[model samples]
Target: MEKEYTIRELTKLCHETAQEKGFWDEKRNIGEALMLIVTELAEAMEAHRIQDQANFKEELADTFIRLFDLCGGLEIDIQEEIDKKAQRNKQRPYKHGKIC
Candidate 1:
């Protein structure tokens, strides 16, 4: 069977896996989500400074995976949000970029 899964579907799988593995509980998973993202991002930045290939790739994947899990647990529509954010960013100019 030629099967395909949407981002939402795949994200839900991550959530399920997390629940089964005790990575999350009955409530929201935002705590774990933020930890996974921020920590990995910091680690990735350090890895980039020293050019650590394995840790960089691992951090990148881990950050993305946590984002997926967060979306699944929070029922966030990421694709539509990304599209909206893209349009918003387009409307902003380099002036704001410098100010911010």
Candidate 2:
């Protein structure tokens, strides 16, 4: 049977690979990781704008990878936080103060 990987497991793998590559060195900071996440978001946006399905998918993956790496580095329980946020959102009003 194939093993199903959890978010935490994937994040740990990404963090380990980053460390091996020297990208997650002692000099690296959360701010830098966050900016890289933002950069990936921008790439995703551009891909969407250009209607490039492949690039869009790749960029989206990159964004998630960066996010996971950041969470791992910070030792954050992202799954718990996501669950809490989702539960809190359930109590929010429809559209939640949005104009749309």
lDDT of model 2 at position 90: 94
* CA lDDT of every candidate: 0.79, 0.87
When summed lDDT is taken over every stretch of 10 residues in candidate 2, the lowest stretch is 24-33
User: Which one is best on lDDT?
Assistant: 2
Q: Global CA lDDT of candidate 2, please?
A: 0.87
Write candidate 2's Cα lDDT for 1-37 as tens digits. Answer: 9988888797898777777888866767778889999
Return the TM-score for candidate 1, rounded to 2 decimals.
0.72
Per-model TM-score, in order, reads: 0.72, 0.85
In model 1, the clashing pairs are none
lDDT of 1: 0.79
